[model samples]
Target: MVLGGSIAGLFAARVLADAYDEVQIVDRDTLIDVAGPRRSCPQGKHINGLLARGQQVMEEFYPGITNEIFADGVPTGDLCGNVRWYFNGVRIQQQEAGLTCVSASRPMLEKHIRRRTAALPNVVFVEQHDILGLATTPDKSKVTGARVQARGQKREKVIDADLVIDATGRGSRTPIWLQELGYGLVEEESKKVGLGYVTQHYRLKSDPYHGDLSINPVANATLPRGAIFTKTDGGRVELTAYGILGDHPPTDQQGFYDFVKTLAAPEIHEALMHAEPLDEPVAFRFPTTLRRHYEKLDRFPDGLLVVGDAVTCFNPVYAQGMTVSALSALTIRNHLHSGAAPQPMQYFQDLSKNVIDPPWEMTNTVDLSFPGVEGERPLQMRFAQKFLKLVQYAATKDKAIAAQYMRAAGLIDGPEKMQRPGFMLKVLLKGIFGPAKKTPAPPLVPIAGGHVETWSEYRNAA
Candidate 1:
């Protein structure tokens, strides 16, 4: 049984279907029938795109899922090849690197994935069911299942199960439930980001961009404000303006425009000037990046596990949320493949090592790089940040640095790859000895092949 019927739950159910006879999902919200909007997911209104590795894993889990998303009219393109990125005030050069990523709205992606999961032979979605709490044994040695209330009812009932996984997201009540079972507090680590943003969808009067799916001017020291424009359905683009360290976007229409005009990248604001608002702006605040150390618990109930945002939640600006959830799902599949249920601690330890540690540490380092954000930074972090500054500078002159940085940022490769002998030589030499002249920017065009295809071409191909 899985708690919460969002992406995490759907994915957990997808893997559990192979090991368990029946995998049931319990969610409080009414499951929608189509790929549209939802009140529960405010983040859906913001920019959400798949990283290169996330796209590859999606294909592995649901083969041809990218093509399906393409047929639905979501934009698809190469990560480093098509997308434009400005980091620390220098625009990184583009390359024909074959890393593929998809820019799809959250609601659409979730809706399609939900449809597929609900169709699985052994999976069931229990919509509008309130998950009251976990059902444990008399001595609280194990979690037998969950207690739930049907929609529009006060009476609660217990649904027994061999395993219970909680993918309830940031609002998970597992800590309280565990304390009720006589367990110690789950340790938590957090960094206050004070990040906030406002997003709106608009249809451009003209396709001024040359088939590009996204353009981002990232937040930096001198300029703390940034914006990202992602291609969406109905010939519209979702543009989001964000600020850090309590510098938030305004809710009013005019104030929002004022914020965008102040961004380091002018394209988003320029396009918006001639665009038509398809929907009003929506605001969302992210207080901090948090991680619950469930794996450190000395005593945890058997037959229970926590995954997804329940374990940790990153700064959404990194776009690591859905990708990390997919990583956890893949880990779950690996642990359950032998068919004998593993201990909860073993599963959690493996999860922390494989899924949580790398990305969590990675994002934490980046967040600390901002002057306004507060955190403890050791020598390693300081050195990494300094080295990365040269890397961004070198990226403007060297295509290899630019492409490798893209791979690292996309989660397809580790950042350390850029530190390799060959790549590091380029950064160290060209970084210290500046280039004789400015390098010409790569042409704004998507790479050919299945690696990248315009939405118009995708429609015709389908």
Candidate 2:
């Protein structure tokens, strides 16, 4: 049994379908047939995209997912070649990292994965149910099932299972449930990131960047504003303006555009000027990033495990949440191949050390670079930032270094890949003697010959 119907939950259900006789999914919201956002998915309503590694896992779990999404009108491209990333106020060089990635509204993509998972004969979606807690053996040594209450019902029903997993995202109740079962408390690490964003959909009236699938200006300490503009289904675009350190993007129409005006790059703001608005600018707040150290617990219930954002929630701008969840799901598939009963402790340990730590450290390090966002910056981060700036500078002139850095950013390669002697020499020599081009923020100007569309001609016209 899986607790939640988010992408994490769906993936878990899909993988578990082969191992278990019947895979049941309990979700708080009603499932939908169409590809659109839902009331339960506040996170999906904003700007969201999958990283290269995420696309790999999703497609691996569901064969032909890439072609499936493309058929749905979601744009596909080379991970590094089609994306323009701005860090520390400078654009990263464009190069083909040879990684397949997709661009679509988060809601639309989730709907496709949900559709695939729901189609499995062994998988079933039990909608409009609240997960009360876990049902365990008398000694509380192992979880037997989950206690759930259907919406508008009084009595709780216990659905027995050989294994129970929680993919309920950042708001999961697993921690509380564990404590109630006499388990030692799991340590939680949280970074107070006062992040918020305003998002709206637009129809791309013009293509100025020459088929670039994505435009992004990341947040930095000097300038805490950022934005992402990308083509989704129906020849329409989604513009998400965001800020950290309590600099919330306003939701008013003009105020929303005003937020765009503050981004490090003018490309997104410029595109919005010529496009049409398909929806009102909506706002969402991400107050903090939380990571639960379930691996630290000495004793955990045998039949229970937590995965995805229920384990660690990253700042969405990095686009790590979905990908990290995918990694965890992959781990689940690997362990299940052993055909042993689920082992929560061993899974958590591997997940924490192999999957969660590196990305969590990288994200916190970048967030702390802002100075306004408070956190510890040990020597590793300090040293990494220096070398990274050098790499960023060198990447503008050297495609080799750019490709390596982009692959690392896409999670296809480890951080150690950038530290190779040959790569380091290239960056060092390029920084020493190269025709460096200065990439200042483009002056924000209106793109001519385009109109603002308040509504869409076709929702998924791809």
User: Best candidate, lDDT-wise?
Assistant: 2
Model 1: runs farther than 4 Å from truth? Answer: 433-454, 457-462
TM-score of each: 0.93, 0.93
- Candidate 1 residues 333-426, lDDT tens each? 8888788765888888998987888788878877888887888899999988777777877777778788988888888887668768988887
The alpha-carbon deviation from the true structure for residue 455 of candidate 1, after best TM-score superposition, in angstroms, is: 2.1
Model 2 bad stretches (over 4 Å): 32-34, 432-435, 439-462
Clashes of each: 0, 4
For each candidate, C-alpha RMSD in Å? 3.8, 3.3
lDDT of 2 by residue, 1-462 (tens): 999888888888888998888999998898858566777788777878788888988988999988888887777677678777776566777888887878878887888899899889999888999999899999999899999999999999999989998998888888898889888887999988899998888765655355466788778777888888776766577788888889999999998888888776776776677677888999999989999999988889899988989999998888898898889988888789888866888899889988888788778777888777777788989988767767877877777787888788788898889889988888888755543555654444343345322112222221
